[model samples]
Target chain A: MKIAVDAMGGDFAPLEIVLGSIEAIRENPHMEVVLVGDEQQIFTILKENNEQKNPRITVHHASEVIGMDEHPAQALRKKKDASVVVATALVKDKQCDAVIAPGSTGAAVAAALFGLGRIKGIDRPTIATPIPTVNGVTVMLDSGANANSKPKHLVQGALMGSEYAKLLLGKANPTVGLLSIGEEASKGNEVVLATYPFLKKLKTISFYGNVEGRDIPKGTVDVVVCDGFVGNVVLKFAEGLVTAVTQLVKDGIMAGGIFAKLGALLVKPAIKKIGKRLDHTENGGAPLLGVNGVFIICHGSSKAKEIKTAINIAGDLVDRKIIEHIQKTIEVEGAFKYEYDE
Target chain B: MKIAVDAMGGDFAPLEIVLGSIEAIRENPHMEVVLVGDEQQIFTILKENNEQKNPRITVHHASEVIGMDEHPAQALRKKKDASVVVATALVKDKQCDAVIAPGSTGAAVAAALFGLGRIKGIDRPTIATPIPTVNGVTVMLDSGANANSKPKHLVQGALMGSEYAKLLLGKANPTVGLLSIGEEASKGNEVVLATYPFLKKLKTISFYGNVEGRDIPKGTVDVVVCDGFVGNVVLKFAEGLVTAVTQLVKDGIMAGGIFAKLGALLVKPAIKKIGKRLDHTENGGAPLLGVNGVFIICHGSSKAKEIKTAINIAGDLVDRKIIEHIQKTIEVEGAFKYEYDE
Candidate 1:
């Protein structure tokens, strides 16, 4: 099996990306990786790190890099050889089983949707990320794929999210919860309220009723589904909050003088572990679900470890035939009713 | 000024309610309190605590109690003399300057909307709460008043929230930010997209365009305005997360052996201060903005101190004429354009 890695994306680009690909292929001896970026940059990193001798890694040269703030569609259209676009194109051309990029999420989504195309009967693809919880992690879908979603899109997201959970989290029957303002079915905006009845009628996924935002960290449901707007806001907020809280604690300890400093030193290791637990980097990458092929989008500041995990996840998804399972779920459950929108 | 207190509401009930009222009136000798609940229960708590002799405190008989889970409109209708409803009635009838309740938020909103009614020319009333940040607090509103809102409603929320920040956080000119998916004005769903232009046009408040969810804790804006659905979800999520993170840290510290244990003891005071800083009780109560009368809603699990703070907040609102200010802002800006929806 082979994977395409975007070697010129994220804050720490070619160096981190190239190192991660080397590490991933070294661990998985059966897998080969095509590093999609500038051939010179990739080769330089490999040589400098004494990893150029690795047989499992090859370079697929791409000239341009997309800015993190670049408009998705415009970036892809203009930079035909962008690392992310080229990486996704490898999967689209059937040269690679999966694509991994630590680039602009919008760019990744745009590239995936346009390059690999959507699966049969899927209206809008979703970006699903697992939020760390006390018990385990909850799969939050449409973490930022479509800003405006129809009811059917959310139902599709639930089914897709459920399958993602089953394969990734190893949950046989993942419970799906609609993200809403209140726990009651009647409580939410028009889209959620309209989607509520449809979700109840779907027999494919185990549908739990509406779950509030508090339910995310509580791990009340295995899969929590919503439109991209709400899901994105919640995801970003959680990420920022974990960092802010950790900083606040450190500042508080620092301001408390010598006794507090001594105590902080004692509990430093425990606090480090706690911080690791709260970090999203521990979860590797978020999957762009509902697309035809495997595309895992990592954080823009992703380091080598996170990229390696993303590669491993991509391999697992391909081996487990997650796309086939999702395709079958949507078909069997008859979730794609185009007439419903009309 | 006289404030009506809902004694039978909240998890702690009449005990905390009575004690808080006593503490409130004792501190503010110029203020009077009406304890609205079953007279026997109120007397039992007051006399048991030997506070029945105070001339500033009086009991108003309320025959019924509304359960926390009871339907809002249904509870107000069925339990006509419910303590929350009666307390609100005191304000509606001009017998009390303000009302404070650590009860079901929905019930309080319903009573205020029905009893006190919307202030003249205000299209919808909003529930505004102060979320603690590293730099003071950011006032967020329509925290959970109307689940569905028109574009004009959000504009009103911003104006009211700005006034709220001024009165509560003491920001003379609060910069209002529309909570959305991105910093760009073009980002967000249909509601926010439509409301953005209105907020930009409104000269009454200093508009800061759009703010993402992370900005809530970052304190990027003085006031963050959104529809009730999003606002309520964010508020609850923040509350739940603070608890979960603190618990995770404590559990981690405990599992780290004797060194960590000793450290925990030493930094315990500093940690306690951080906890208090994050505590919503420190902010006192969330105001039901846009209503004709002042109504401060405390947390359902509020203790004596929290209730006391709510009472104090109510006094401040009444004394500062917050309602009059809100009414003046709305009227001057001409935000109540009922025909605009058409």
Candidate 2:
């Protein structure tokens, strides 16, 4: 399998992206990587990592790079030769099976929508993010793809999320839950209330009534479906809370004097293990589902390890034929029959 | 001042509620409490706590009790003599200065709207929840009061929340941030986008542009204003994430063998301190702002400590004349001049 990596996308840019791609190719003998960015920068990093002449490693030249803060659609339109768009184009042209971009989420979504286009029946593409829960991970869809969504869009997200959960999380029958403030069918805002009945009537996915915000961390359901607005807020809030909690622990130790310092040293390994489990990098990137091709979006601050994992995840998706599964499920279930305003 | 307590409200109702009220009055020499619930149950708990004949303690009989699982508006309409409604009625009738309900948030909101009514010129009442942050507290308005809100309603919420910060958080000039997925003014859903221009044009609040979900935990602004749907989901998600993190730390310690166990024992005190700092109970209860009377709503699982703090908070709100301040701010700012749909 071959995958295209946008080397000039994230904060670490070409160097870290190149190193991670090299590492990913070394671990998977049958896999190959095409690093899309400035040729000179890619080659210099490859030489420094001692993989410059490796047969499995290749470089594709792209003149422009999109900054982290650039407006996605505008940047994609102006920078026609941008690394992220070029990488996505490789997948569109069937040069690679998948593409990975570790830049602004908006840019990634725009590149996918513009380059590969959406599947036939899907109205909008979604970003399925894996959140670490108590027992395991729960996949939340439309994490930040579309700012505003209709009930039909959420129904499409649920179908796509259910398929992703089955392939990625290894769930036999994924139970989908609508994210809401209350657990009752009669609860939530107008959008949620309208979406609930559609999910209940659907036959392709297991609709698990309604789940509250707390239920996400409790691992109450396999897939959580919501519009991008609420899903994005919840995702970012979880990240912030984890950081604040860790800082609180560090401050507590400082205030405890000498005894707490010694205790922290003794339990350093245990704390490190916990951090690893909760680390976002360990899960790689969230897949931009419903797109025509495989597209994974990593965090902007992603380093070499995260990029490598994301490449491996892209390979797994290709092997499982995730896009094919989503297309078939949507068609068979007739998800497009629901009335939606353009 | 006298405050009415919903003695039949929470999980540990009557017993814990009565004890909390007794403790609150003991701390505030000038304060009195009226326990509104079934007379027999309240008296039995009061006698057990040795406060049956106390001069400052009083009991008002309300034959019906609203269960936690009951629907809010329906239950309020059917069970006219419910404990929560009676407590709120005490404040409406001017028999008590304020009311504290440590039960279903829906019941508290419903009773407040029905009994005390909304403030003049205010379209809806907002729940201003005080979230503990790294620096101090960040007050988020419309946390769960109205699931759906318009731009004008949010503008009213901002004015009410700013006044709340000035009085409760002790901010001389509080800055308010409109919560959105991005920091840019053009980045949120339809409602948030429409609300931005109104907030910027208004002279009452110090508009701090847009803030993301992470800003809430980081204490980036004094007041974070959003419609209740997003605010409620973010609030509950924070609670869930904190619990999940704590459990992760515990599981880590247990997995690291005997040394980790010993380390945990040595650092128990420091850990307890951190836990106390992050505890929601420490902040007491969130006030239902924009109402005609002072109404504080506590968590459903609140214990005696939380109830006590909430009662104390209710007294503080009455002393500060929070309702009058909110009313004045709305009238002075001409917040009702904006066009809105009912």
Best by TM-score: 2
Tens-digit lDDT track for model 2 on B1-342? 999999999899988888889889889899999999999998998888888998899999999988888999899889999999998989888999999998899989989998998999898899999988888889999899888888988899999999999988898789999999999887999899999998998887899999898888888999999989888888888788778877888989999999888888888899898788789999888999988899999998888889899988888888898888888888888888886545
What TM-score, to 2 decimals, does candidate 1 have?
0.97
Question: Lowest summed-lDDT stretch of 10 residues in model 1 chain B?
Answer: B333-342
What TM-score, to 2 decimal places, does chain A of model 2 have? 0.98
Q: Which model scores highest in DockQ? A: 2
Work out the TM-score per prediction: 0.97, 0.99
Off by over 4 Å in 1: A338-342, B338-342
Q: List each candidate's DockQ score.
A: 0.73, 0.77
Which lDDT tens digits does candidate 2 get at residues A1-342?
999999998999988888889889989999999999999999999988889999898999999999988888889889999999999999999999999999899999999999999998898999999988988999998899987888889999999999999988898899999988899998898888999998998889999988888888988999999889888888888888778877888999999988888888888889898788789999999999999999999999999999999999999999999999999989888989877545
The CA lDDT at A3 in model 1 is 93
